[model samples]
Target: MSLLQVSGLTRRFGGLVAVDGVEFNVAEGEIVGLLGPNGSGKTTVLNLLSGALAPDGGSIRFGEHAIHGLAAHRIARLGLARTFQLVRPLGSMDCRDNVIAGLAFGAERRWGSAAQREADDLLARVGLEGRGHAMPGELTYIDQKRLELARALALRPRLLLLDEWLAGLNPTELLEGIKLVQSLRQQGMAILLVEHVMDAIRSLCDRCLVMSAGKRIAIGLPGDVLSDPDVVRAYLGDDHA
Candidate 1:
């Protein structure tokens, strides 16, 4: 059975339909790429799945729970976690403290020295090792992204939603990020990745789900769907395809 099942998911903003009848499944330990051009509603879907935004319609099932319209904290407690397209770390808190917050609040809650230790370990895992005492503003953009990812992992989530997590990285950092995501999947974590870096999508995702204008356009293996005329047209325009 799929770890996550989303069907007929829809969301609206005034007159704009940001996500329209989108549907997909993410199996246990599978990494599915949410691919789309700008304004394709990929992040909107993430918001719906992670409970940052309630859907206007459709159903979301994570394991045994039907989670449509659940609050974000409740969803996190139920073993789903997400990182923002823009990294959000506590400005005043140090990196380790930020991760500790996640540890305290997530599904498998921890506290005291154990949480501290785990927080430090998470920082190390995401390559923020000795920078635990540094504030969010002290880190570079890419490091900030890593810090956010570390916090999400602290949730010990069954499914993770990453919104443009690999966006600002240089080539080398991008490779490391890809490997880190792969390691998580290896350890049995399911991931829904929203990324424009086609290299990472091709290398890390088990399957690709493409969207355009808030609608699902295609879903298939990376190579197959990426090459489809419809998919090509969605990204580069009618002339390119």
Candidate 2:
């Protein structure tokens, strides 16, 4: 069975149907990309899967358990953790503290010491070596994002959801972020990424899914999906395709 499964998932925001019966499966250790233009329901899908918003219809299964209506904390405890588009580092804490908070709080097997050590290692891996004591305001934007990735890893999540983790970074930061995420996949983590940056998605994602007007329009290999006429027209216009 797929490690993460969503069948006929739907979510409505009053007059708008943000996610319209989207169904997909993510297997263990796979890196899947969720791509779409603004208001295409990519982030909405991540939010629903991560329990920040409950689904209006259908179901989600992480492993063998039903998770559609579980509370955020409850879902996290079930081996799922997520990173947000906007980094939410504790304003008053240092980088290490922010990551430590994730280890202590997110759903996962208890391993305080191991989690802290793992967090530190992850920081180093993401090129933030020895800057763990710096606060969010003190670090550069890239470092702040690196801390966010470390924080999520502290949960040792089986399925990790990342929403635009590279949105604001420059070219150099974007490259590093891709490497970080790809490295996570190598560590046997199943990842769901909602990304606007096509270059990153093309390079890091094993498979790509496109959404438009709150519905999935295409899903396939990155190269095939990127070149699809429908996907191109949705965001890049016909001439670009």
User: In model 1, where do residues sit more than 4 Å from their true spots?
Assistant: none
Q: Model 1: how far is 4 from its true place, Å?
A: 0.5
- List TM-score per model, in order: 0.98, 0.93
Please give the range of 10 consecutive residues that has the lowest summed lDDT in model 2: 107-116
User: Cα miss at 196, model 1 (Å)?
Assistant: 0.7
Residue 105 of candidate 1: its Cα lDDT?
Answer: 94
Model 2 CA lDDT for position 208: 90
Q: Which 10-residue window of candidate 1 scores lowest in summed lDDT?
A: 43-52
lDDT of 2 by residue, 38-152 (tens): 9999888989988899999989999989999899888888889888888888889888778788778765543567766766777787788888778889988778877888888
> Taking the tens digit of each residue's C-alpha lDDT, what string does model 1 give over 38-64?
999999999999888999999999999
Assess each prediction's global lDDT (C-alpha) against the native. 0.94, 0.86
Measured on C-alpha atoms, candidate 1 has an lDDT of: 0.94
